[model samples]
Target: MAIPAQAPPAEEVVADPVPPPDRRRSILARIWGVYAIRRIVYALSVVWLVTTGTFFMIRAMPGDPVEVLAGKLSMSGLTMDVARVRAEQALAWDPNANIFVQYFEYLGNLLRGDFGMVIGLHNTSVLDHIMKYLPWTLFSVGLGVVVAILLGMGVGMIMAYYRNGLFDHIMSAVASTLSAIPNYLGAMALILIGSTWLGLFDFWDMRGRISIGVEPGFTGEFIGDALYHAILPLITYAFTITGGWMLVMKASTTEVLGEDYVTVARARGLKGRRIGMSYVGRNSILPLIPQVALAIGTLVGGAVIVEKILFYPGIGELLIGSITTRDYPVIQGVVLILTCAVIFTNLLVDLLNSWIDPRIRKEGAST
Candidate 1:
């Protein structure tokens, strides 16, 4: 009887059917879900748009390069026809070509690493000009940004810690005033107060990136002289930007101080210093990381005005001269460089943000 019962129970024990894998979705996810790849594509698209716009806009300006050169040559007693011929011959680009044609050519040349030659400057390569001037601007502005960020973050943390006290009130007011001032205005004020009113430093002596006789090297004399000339612009940049940083960090820190983790850390008997730094300060600074890259771009653009004011020989100064002379190649080259700088920096910051915050990477992947 037991054997008969066991024999009756051995019916079909079929397994559940397994669905086929979604190969298409899996492939699409691999291609589009990568955060760095998306950011890079976006950056490249922006660079292309900027390059195109800059190319056309420069050509659309009221005066042409040939006319500008011709006018200058006429001032030197050459006949108008000869001056025009010389201008045409000296230019790396054709003034009479269709703009669309020139644009395509420019793009082709750009792809080949050819930036064309600077007009009215003995046909110097645009890349060479940039190499010569970009470093000074980077040195001055980069140092200033670093100093401003450090000073501002520290002061901001203090302001948040002492919220609404006398020191906070004083600093808030100072920050507001400084932030309201334009960077060029800051440069001017520094010149006025330091040179005109107080006679603290001679404007003439500080007009360039360095003293005339200092050779370029790692030597102390060259370094010291470069710093001396850079001091005014650096100070102007630091103070002008520091105020904004302080205000931002203060707001960020204040918000973080009210966060649950910060509160929990405090309640867990963590020391004030440890809690303030490890929990509050660290979280507060996270939002500012993206801003640092943006600040670099902003500073580079602002350098045009500040460098012009200071007579500092940075790319900004070169850009101004190019614009004034209608040097199309140099103008296009400088603007393209600046645009690339800003776009790529933002891309890098995005990737860095993804690395710093897992949530960002997760969100990016899901998309």
Candidate 2:
């Protein structure tokens, strides 16, 4: 009876249940949790919308490419019907085709990397036209932005350090006034003050992107000549934009200076230069990163006016000419390129910001 009691004492063990895999949720999280992937999708969607809008809007303009080319041909002694036929053949476009059909065709061509031929210009590629002129705009506007950011940030930090002092007061007023002035007006003022009244440099000499004689190369002479022509547009862009950067930087810097960490750094007996550079300056610059990306788009738009006034042969200049001639292919191509540039820059900046700031990455991942 004791042996039987001992044998009955063995207890059974129970295993814990395993959870099922959430395959659907895991897939969604993998796709959506990635910040760069989301941003790229958004950018691509924007490009598609812009491309669609640009295609329709250009067609909606008063004259069609056929009509415009025909008009020019009619001026050269061809009958209207004959001119239209020639135009249609040359442009390889059909005005009578279904609008939706044309749109789909355009999308197909775009997918295949075909921007189409320039209307009225026999066999000229739209991509070639863009490649030819885009660099000038990038050089002038891009250089101007860099210079303005550097100069503005330096002066702004100084203003923040010397807050309410005479230097600060003077700069604040000047920055406010300059920021209020339109860039085009500032450009005209430069022409009037520097070229017309001051006679510091001849506008005629600096009218184009570069002097005709200078060959395109990495040589110093070529570089100097290019800079000489870009100087006015550069000055206009830098001068007009610098004020805004200064104001923004001054505000950001001032805010950073008041933070507890800055006060603690001062308490720790850190040198003024070290505190300014390492603590205040670095923290203050974060907000400006997004703004700088946006400013690239704004500057490109402004280049239309500035380049037009200055006679610089950039994409802006090309765009203006395309519009004047009702060159739908060229106009569409240019607008598409501009839109892509803006979207690409913003997307790049978003990725860069996420990389630089762990907080952004964390927030994005949770969402």
Candidate 3:
């Protein structure tokens, strides 16, 4: 029995030392790690889907860009054989290539920034056209959405803190009314007020961010002019989107306020301001990130209405114009761009949500 004290029972023996907990990551490091991984995956997936889908879907459309281009070039009068040869040469299209081969070639060219040409747009490269206006659209709508989130979240928090007070009731009524109104209709009314009645805005002079005759480059003057031109449309977008975010924030705050943790914090003799700022604000506001991302993504496309109303030269206008003209390549290209943007935005939201809510990170750790 004393033969080496018999190492006790196996169950009584100390197990291997449990690993120590990881140090809590600095906020910046955690955010960067989540964002970098999310972006890498998002970009790779978007490129894969867009490239393959573009090749096949573009080819599958009822009309051909090459034929459309040739017709616009007045080559419609040529013999069928000549027309066919010309179309092939113009598009560098190969009817006999396998689907995979065509897809690879299309992706290769896209990677090289050769986005082909718009058929009726007089030999303008799709990429070139997009580059010309994408920035304005992103800036206008993107800034508008930021303004919306601020207004919505700020007002909603105020209403939520007030609970059943007059401000809350008023906001509830206003949100209900605005949520039912379509964005285009709201935009139309804003346009009538700002552009027609007040005469504060000029709709016809829209070209680039600045006036039509402004220099064709980015400068402080150009940026200031563009921001000035963007103000009306930005206001319209902010107003239109505010209702949804406000409602979301209000509901989330109300729910979060009722939680036991909040009550416990209050019982700990935490001041109203401390509880509101730390417990209520942190928990309730997380619901807004995804909503903000979605709103931003949606605004990227829906900005067309406001753009048309304000006559701003942006990607939204380009999309509207492309649709009307049935410029398939350009339309498809823009759709692809917007789709990729949305997907990436969504991925970012998911990653951000995980970061903000540690339960998600804990679950990931267990796996």
Best by lDDT: 1
lDDT at residue 318 of model 1 (Cα atoms): 93
Distance from true location, Cα of 12 in model 2, Å: 26
- The digit string of per-residue lDDT tens for model 1 on 218-336 reads 99999999999999889989989999999999999999999999889888999999998799989999878888988888788778999999999998999999998988888989998
What does candidate 2's lDDT look like per residue over 1-367, in tens digits? 4654455666777764743468667887788888888889889999999999989988888887888889999999999999989888887567689999999999999999999888777778999978899999989999999999999999998999899999999999999988898888988999999988989999998999878878999999999999999998899899998998998999999999999999999999999999988999899998788778778777886788888898889998999999988887888888888888788888878888788787887897786
Specify the highest-TM-score model's number.
2
Report the CA-based lDDT of candidate 3 relative to the real structure: 0.73
lDDT computed for candidate 2: 0.88
lDDT of each residue in 1-367, candidate 3, tens digit only? 5555556556566665753345344554565455446466657788677756765666676766555645655554786667656656665447567868866776677778676676545668898889888888888778888987888888888888898999999998997777677667777887678678998766555334677566755698777777777777777778788887788889888899899999999899999999988989888887676667777887786766667656776887888887655565577678778776777776677677776777876665444
Model 1: lowest-lDDT 10 consecutive positions: 1-10
| TM-score against truth, every candidate | 0.84, 0.85, 0.70
Clash count list over all predictions: 0, 0, 0
